[model samples]
Target chain A: MSNAIDRGKIEALKSMLLSLHKGESIEELKRKFKDVLETISPVEIPLVEQELVREGVSISEILRLCDLHVELIRDTLRSSLLMDVPKGHPVSLISRENEHIAKLAEALNVYAGALSKASSGEAESHLKAISNILAELRKSRLHYRKIQMLIFPYLERRGITAIPRVLWGREDQVIVKLRELSTLVEKELTHPKEYPNIAEKAMEVSREISDLIFREERILLPAVWILLSEGEWVAIHEAAKDIGYLIPIDVEWASRAKLLLPYEVNGVVTREQVESLPQEFKFAALATLAPDTYEVRSEEDLEFETGFLSKDEVEAIFRHLPIEVTYADVNDRVTFFSQSIFRKGFARTKTIIGRRLGYCHPPRLEHFVKSNVDDLKAGKS
Target chain B: MSNAIDRGKIEALKSMLLSLHKGESIEELKRKFKDVLETISPVEIPLVEQELVREGVSISEILRLCDLHVELIRDTLRSSLLMDVPKGHPVSLISRENEHIAKLAEALNVYAGALSKASSGEAESHLKAISNILAELRKSRLHYRKIQMLIFPYLERRGITAIPRVLWGREDQVIVKLRELSTLVEKELTHPKEYPNIAEKAMEVSREISDLIFREERILLPAVWILLSEGEWVAIHEAAKDIGYLIPIDVEWASRAKLLLPYEVNGVVTREQVESLPQEFKFAALATLAPDTYEVRSEEDLEFETGFLSKDEVEAIFRHLPIEVTYADVNDRVTFFSQSIFRKGFARTKTIIGRRLGYCHPPRLEHFVKSNVDDLKAGKS
Candidate 1:
């Protein structure tokens, strides 16, 4: 009923979280703030959380507590947030797709339940279920592509980078793990021992992924709805068209459609438009959610301390290097790989760019690589 | 001293190493193979280690046993690997630099001995000692750069890539840790709590540096001597000339240098020849240790199903991409980074190649990246 955010309620939540981090017993934490803990609505969670961060609570600390916060609020979380979905809106479609993805993950996990042991029915059917799950999991890549291209850039432009930094990294980890599990199933099909591990990994991944979808819908979508402008959502929907989503939308945001129509004039609908347009148009109004877009211009040649080169020349120089180069960022996300002319040192594709470092080698060698990296970091080597 | 390649002797060593890995009690191992283990030479350790790898032992498996093998052979490992160093030999110069590095390390560790407690010295002197060590530790970069450029390419060409893979990755790691320690000391000067940790890290790093030098002189040099050819060593020395070693060589490999000179008709010494030659040439014959070098032919441009791309075009394509990329191979040694025209993402140089992935971030974030990578690989995320 109240429009104003309660600063005292937020402080209670913050102190509870800080106390929890200080190794305070959860029982004590609950006892200390029993009234506030029970009364805090899920709708206020992100608002208070964001405000805490703005007031200098560490993003990493918030990340450490995020899921725990969600868990604590799970019961009261459902009834609080009011959905004001506009039919055919980009946010509306994304919310629907989140539900679909959760269903898909649940369906796979149910099928995977048949695969706890190699002795469960026909090995052939069990493996078939796994193969089918792998196929559907592969479609999650489309979900990821949408998030990376559409949502992340929008979040970043809104200075909501912490979520993308922490959350999208988790997404990349999920994809890499999915790929790993798929490879295990595909390559080691004859080994029955691989089945149990596959089922376990698949179930875990599916559950984690479904949880991610919930976070997006509950925390992220509402924030985007409030923060973004109309034209930005239009750009996002347009980009999503270029890189499709997990599920197709059956509706479009109608109030923005008039603004979207390039040839429409004076708020008047022509007779031809009435006949040619889709038979039924949903009446949905939006205050428009627009995200900022960056413009890239290649104005001139790149000059280095040692020499100068055109963009073409710089590209040529990298390509001409005797060895192939692939770069994984500090976050282990593959950002680029040079296509070597001398010899294609390591084969890489565009899709691999946003993935983590785990897939670049045979799975067995991954540990050794990882250990060496750790030792290098810890000065143990 | 048998000059013969005794098959039984090699097998015995391999089996001992394998048994050690199999978690055979070290006491039992000592009882079973006490005679052989104590007598194994430093040169024989790598020889047996390399042979074990060739005989179906995984290189990674050997890596696990590497330290244990070093420990087992520590007693008489010193006496058996005889150095036939000529005064001006490249090996001799490297050996001298190893001594310098070891002493440098020992000196720092000794200085670091003061700071175990906060009361070890004036905070000013403690900081100054750390600063000096950091400056010297930074020079390990030169030791690394030379090895990457001069030795690794030659090793890979010789099909001796396993050594480069393991050893060079370790070197890259050392350089990265060195860089990390330097940053911590530089940034955390005002924090007294940071100094004891710095002291501990510096001591660890210095001791490791000294141990690395010992490995180089005792194991690697001897291995290089046996495996490489005269021209390969000359090429290594030549490449070393380009890259520079940790410390400059006051001597030259002259028999090779005379051969390095273009055809001179007269065998007799002339006054003009003596005057014209570079004054710094000191006679050092390397017992003529050389490595096998591969002749690389530029057969043609790389062809893929997508289309053929010239080295230039491939470079252009990578440079044209929006993201900067660097490739660290399965060993975590950085092989390459693409220079994107849009943003110089990670400031990488030629020196970074043959270095580990640890160099990509701060010491704190290195663990974060490594853990993420391992989690991705393990399918844990």
Candidate 2:
């Protein structure tokens, strides 16, 4: 199915594009291309691009054709989108933040338009509103940061690296443009001649933010909603709490689902899981079958001198201990350490486990610890 | 302060103990020993016992004296108890379960009395009621098991071993008695002539369970409430969910406190912590000061070839991965491995880190893995 492309479906989609190129309005094309849209899935877009390139079509022309295709399928994307989620859920909270930012972006555009049209008296008030909106818009970085940190990693783990990287790149661009536009806005306040430039820049930043919001709501989040499990959502909710929300999250979303990491996902989307997915994802997911091989799920007890404990219990015991305890072998190479959750004494990574004990401590305390270790080794302590 | 006890206070308590032994009722002694009770703390019990021993008092006599002292302090212990907690909090839930079990024990006693008094016709209904009560009482083992598993480990880590162990002993007795009495009750249903013996055993079990309830409410819970932090309670609540509650817990108790284990507690109880403690714990807490010692609270990032990540971040990255990744040194000794949350394929503990790679797997897979490693080492397909 991955290798075989339906030539008939491709020809049908290409003819739809040809019909639109011959001066058919987008609305008119949408009505005609509805059947063709169902036939051509999103995964087939790359292959279609390849086939179109192999013919006499230019790359820029293909991109224009793809953009027209997206416009035609916009309703389909919205219809298959995440319409409702439990309040306080990660997806719901993120979508709420997106809604808030969209309003701010709309307000920014309105203020920018007002500033350009205002009389001298109204210009002050309009500029003030623009600055305030920019300040609020700047806080959306927290929203974008959460997307990059909490959500993107799961996609990366599932081998969907390109999408997250591309989205992150666009998110970073929005952040950078906002910062530069803020500086320009500040300059505009002093020299009033720079008003035109600031207004243009603000509108551009506003447009970029709106575009990202559309991409998130239509593509990224809906796709993630299909791909990530409840356990992954729980983790995202926990990590997102530290980053915080644009709007207050008063309700507590509770689930009995255990914490499942990306590595815990066996790569294969089972038939039941695929069946539950929306139409847009089902075709792509069914076509791309990943191997469900070699998972490690061991909860067997390990007997110690004191008692029997599972590895998780042992790990938890070590983490909860108050003091730092690192062990060095007789050869003086680091072997193990207790990973106290509140590690206040010294900074050490698991990478330090195989390193020499001398390199484990801060340089100032290195000699003192080395001497103490030596004294103990020599039975002099 | 731990080593030294006020001799005047000890002598006062000794005389009070003597008064109880010399034909005074516990109620009369309690009235007389009000001032002496203020002078002597619970920690001073051992010191007063030592003084009584030096005065040539018999151990049995001193034990009776101590029992009288406990009766005198009953009001004081009750006064310093955990009066209220959020509905779904672990301590609150456990206390609620205790209340339910106490009512069941009372019903068991009532049913036993009725069975002994009723004619043969009424005995059937009375016995049925007793059997039902016994079934409910048996479920209390879930409650006891939680205390032993979830709560005791924290107390053990805090170096307060004896209390958890002693309470656990009494809890085990209740469980064992309930099992034995359940079997005997079945026998009584058939034989009917065993009513006298069954009634006597039922009363004994009822008394024992009631006594445990008194101890848990007065001593165990009050001590635990004072000693445990919010984080510990959160962990207890999470673990208790798996064991389940005897009563329904409708409300979701929420806390923002991070998971702080017993080992994370620096031994010293700060002045602020002491100030917040109930009157019963303050004196003992203030007198016994332990070393604050070394704490590890590092959040510094470790630079890797790809990017900089905190140790926790690296640990989390490993945990959340969808695949089990184990790295061995050139010597074929395991150095590091991803600790996947769901270890489905193999049961390897952290102890396997320094073990030879061949021994890390099952015997059958050991040779297969070894051959593959050798082939890779020699650059063979």
Candidate 3:
């Protein structure tokens, strides 16, 4: 009975897309989309879209239809398709990150709005605001990097191949464009004649940013929602903490999360209970995670020729260091790196720590890394 | 009794050094040195030398005398001052490494001799030989790096500060010269006119390598002998196994040690008795090591996005890769590296793994790393 109903919805999806393609009225398409949406499941949506493509709708045309579909189903999505998550979940963190990014995008749009006006005339201040907001948005690179490193690798491991291959490449391009736009805007700040050139790039960047937000919400999140388990979500969040959020994480918000809240009928929680419970519970959650990355050392202090130190002191010193240091041993294993606190010289994570350097780069460039290492070991270079 | 004897030797050391500076004969100085050697242990050697310096002997004059003093007491020195170590101890490994280096130096000397003897006839063969040997000698950089990463850091920790600071810089210079010498020899191969330059650089490199061996065995070893405990030697040896020896380690020699051999009266121990008793006892030896660096993770496999892997597989895969991977965590701590199989790229250790990146480098060039990281993170570069 369910199979027959899905088949009917798939047929309806094709005809609605076909009419939307034939320049049907927005009102007519919305009415058709709303009626069909009632019967369509998330799993069937992809199958229906694939069917529409086979029936001669171009991917670009379908992508346009997808945007319109979102408009018609937006209210319904809020109630059904979008799953609400408790705090500390990966999806929840990603959603919060997306919300932060949206605010940054909004600020950029406001600045661009004033700049577009012929006589707004506060060019210097407007440029400053543009640069500042762009700088804030630039930190989205960290969020993207977390996805690339912590999330995508896990997705790839689970045989979810397409997103990492396609979306990962696109994400890298986004960061590159974001960097170029920042440089272009900074140049315009110094030279007024360059404003037109930078303005064009800035507008391109803005559109790309808007499109990225759209794809992440409408496409990326939904795919990830069903794929990742509760445990994997917690692991990603643990890794994400080291990468950090764009803004200061709200301790109060995290402390008062719903799932962990004690059930009470108007009973006041004590200060001691409130302060210690969350952290205690958080550690307990992590302890249940896979042991590999979170291997807690049994010993307290490391012995050296001079004296010994706690692990925390050694880690603190590494962070405080001015120069970044990395050590790859004789076998060419990268054994350690001093992550600098002053600036992020490069992107790295625990997954990359043990990954073959060959696999680290794209397949096309893998041979280059291989040859250089050979030449170096052979003392040819 | 020991303190009174040491006081008497300190006075003798000053008088003998003054006489040596004023052109005393070897016979005269040897007689005085023999008597003083009875009272002076390795720990007291530095104090005796300091007394000589205060009594108006120049450091250079004293260093020259120290070499002659070693020659004078060479035979007696082995019996008295040269402390023996167990088969698998760090000192024994260093001795074996030294023996291997000496053989390479000897080969280089022989090759250089033939190349220097008025031979323009076999330039191709000679260049190949030079290139081959120099390439072999370049692997000494791994040995030198081990000294820097493993030994010097420990020495520095033990408050034997001056030698590590001075020698570490000099060792870096030797590696640099070795690289330059290789380039010069390569140019000589292509263009014959570069032979004079190449020969000069080769000679300098040859001298530096020989001098390094002398200082390490003579000066460094004695200092280390008194300063490091037996447990420390084994710990260093364990860490050394990961970095590896310059030559293939002879397991046979390591297995057959004398000190731990029972004072048996014509009775050979069986394999079962040896295996069980030694392993059980060795644990007791390692149990005393300062725990920080040696905190081995008990779990077998590391959990990744795709699946789980034994730490052995992760290490094996890391070793086989062409590229080197290092991860400095968000806190800027040197966390881990994959030492690759192709060529040794960088030197690292468990101690340095947790160390601050700031302390790894010199202060003067610190800002270059800091600024570059800032620019990268700011998306300004």
Candidate 4:
């Protein structure tokens, strides 16, 4: 049966990772499992790794073998289709952040190499460069946060849990390592004794970050691009705006598509959907997916602490109100304002949405509004 | 030199219109002014009419001459390009509503004809049918309301004031006639002597509505479509939603273009812009438009009664607020909910921005929410 072959392949992948963790060379392990590596699907690597974690193989140990695992299956992932995500779309923004993260990772490694070989007289500059790169590299957490928060839920709803778990584990490891490396580099600024050790740690974190980027661009984005509908993407894109982006985003990629939430999907990937998926995800897409059974309102409906309401009803209420209401968020951004049916007290249009509160006022009143906002923030009002 | 020629043309047009007002036959007048009618621009009709009013020619006289005027220049206006407006766009929506309005107008005429031929027994039924059609016909006011509120302001802001004024005059006449016909029909049920008079008024109103529709589709839409940017269309589309429509609108036509207000335009239509306009509008587009010199805040800034604030500052203030806020309008529609930076009160997303307040709550609380809304409307709370 195909199940037998799948089990055999996962077992082989697990052993190869275990051999790499036990100090076997990646090249040697890759050669020994060349046939298995070539046949391994992108989704299978994560499943096997999750299995190893359950069997008491430590996360750090698996993290150590990640580069080896990535190396083994690099060719297979590389051959999967690369989607041309449109500019300003959530996927495109994530991919752009990864490119920036990759450059910083490479910079950290380069400066680490320089720190290792630099004469004692020139060692301070290299340490400073390494520290700067590490701090910049730490900002990749925002990039990772979007993936975990905005994208993972859609995949988890489809029962594709292993990929998120494995990717998250690697991302967490890099985050922790980057923090420690920053602390170590600062301490070394005075002691100057752990130069070689700090250099080695920097290289390790750099490699881990690089490996995660490869997995995201090759495995995760391509799979989601195929699986998520325009509605889901619209939901993701809208929510992601609140979280902020790592880059200056382009003009919004407006979608007239209806909003769709993860809970709305039936958790079944049809044969046609599977056929459209990249080679890296075809098996996972075709696999039996556990239905997301959590009961929820329609995506157009909002569940407040009191009850639920659809979007149409909400908009109607605002327009029907007698008094005009304007709301500025904590950061002084003009996020929303109400338009009364009979009269608008002042000239306010949808264009004013997302503009700065200070700028909404004339120059004379700008200071007055800012002070009022400050007073409110200080709990004086 | 061109001003003299323009003056001579206006004088000739005035004389021809005065002759028509003096009970001249339309066919005879068309022969007399064939050259002037052929060369008359779309904007000139409104301008010359405005002039005639300034020179003491009554609006009723001009209204009487309208059919003659339309007949004489119909061939030239017919040669103007008809744009294939995209579905759901404001222009397309207006045109679609006009299509429905035209059908009602035709139906009114048909019923009026039928009423003229009906016996005393059949006359009451014809009167009932006329009343039903008139009730439906009166709903076209909502269509006219959108044009007056949403579309006309953009033109007026450009200092092209004559067209909106002339069109509104025609629209007002049709509305008043429709009302009077409804009243006369109701009274005719008791006193059948005025049946012929009621039928004649119905035909007249129908013809007027048809003429207004022709003017809207041929003159106004084509001109504004050329003048307004995607941003302006976005603003118009957003504002028009509150006014409702004559017909069920198609899906929203979204544009990612930045919002541009009429005041933001320099009030000058360049040579290139004039060239791109429809043949009927070329003279208007090229004319020396009076500058709209009223100063205002940027389109992205909202001018409140107390002060003004740009959209960004307003949004920031809302986001930084500690407590989550949800707002429902007078109609119990949930128009807005504040998104706190920290903990959210519930699963309120942007998707629920326009939802019904009752639907946003649990089923058990739906009744409670409804009563609270009713009590608020009653001003008891």
Could you give the TM-score of chain B for each candidate, in order? 0.50, 0.54, 0.47, 0.58
Q: Is candidate 1 or candidate 3 better by DockQ?
A: 3
Best prediction by TM-score: 4
lDDT of 2 by residue, B1-381 (tens): 274677787677667767767878877876887787776654345445555555655444555554543443344444355766667888878877876776677557656655555677867776777888899999998888777666765554444445655677777777888898888878768877767566668767877887787777676777677777888787677668867889999788988887654435544555776676655456656555453222222345443321233445445544644555565545665445555665666433332333346544333454699899999689685
Q: After superposition, how far is residue A25 of candidate 1 from its true place, in Å?
A: 82
DockQ of 1: 0.01
Candidate 4 — which residues are off by over 4 angstroms? A1-80, A278-280, A298-302, A305-381, B1-338, B341-381
- Tens digit of lDDT per residue, candidate 3, span B1-381? 132235677677667767877888767677767766555644344335544544544444555444443443343333232456556566656655765665455445434534554257755675677798789888776676556555554443322334555666677677788788788788778877755456556656665676677667666665555444454444455556656778776652333222110001112223343233323222322333331121112264333322233445445544655665554444444455555557554333332343334333323435776676667557675
Per model, kept true contacts as a fraction are 0.00, 0.00, 0.00, 0.04
- Candidate 1, after superposition: displacement of residue B269 in Å? 39
Worst 10 residues of 1 chain A by lDDT: A279-288
Once superposed on the true structure, which residue ranges of model 2 sit more than 4 Å away at CA?
Answer: A1-81, A119-122, A271-381, B1-381
Better of 3 and 4 by lDDT: 4
Residue-level lDDT of model 4, residues A1-381, one tens digit each, is: 022237777578668767876888878887888787778754344445445544555444555444654454344544255545777888878876776676676556656655666667767887988888888888887787777666776776676765666677677778888998899999988888879788778877877887887777777888888788899899888878867777788767878998776656656666777787766577666564574454444575555433344545444544554556677555565455666665745345554444446545434455688898899889786
Instruction: Point out the worst 10-residue segment of candidate 1 chain B by lDDT.
Output: B258-267
DockQ values for all predictions?
0.01, 0.01, 0.03, 0.02
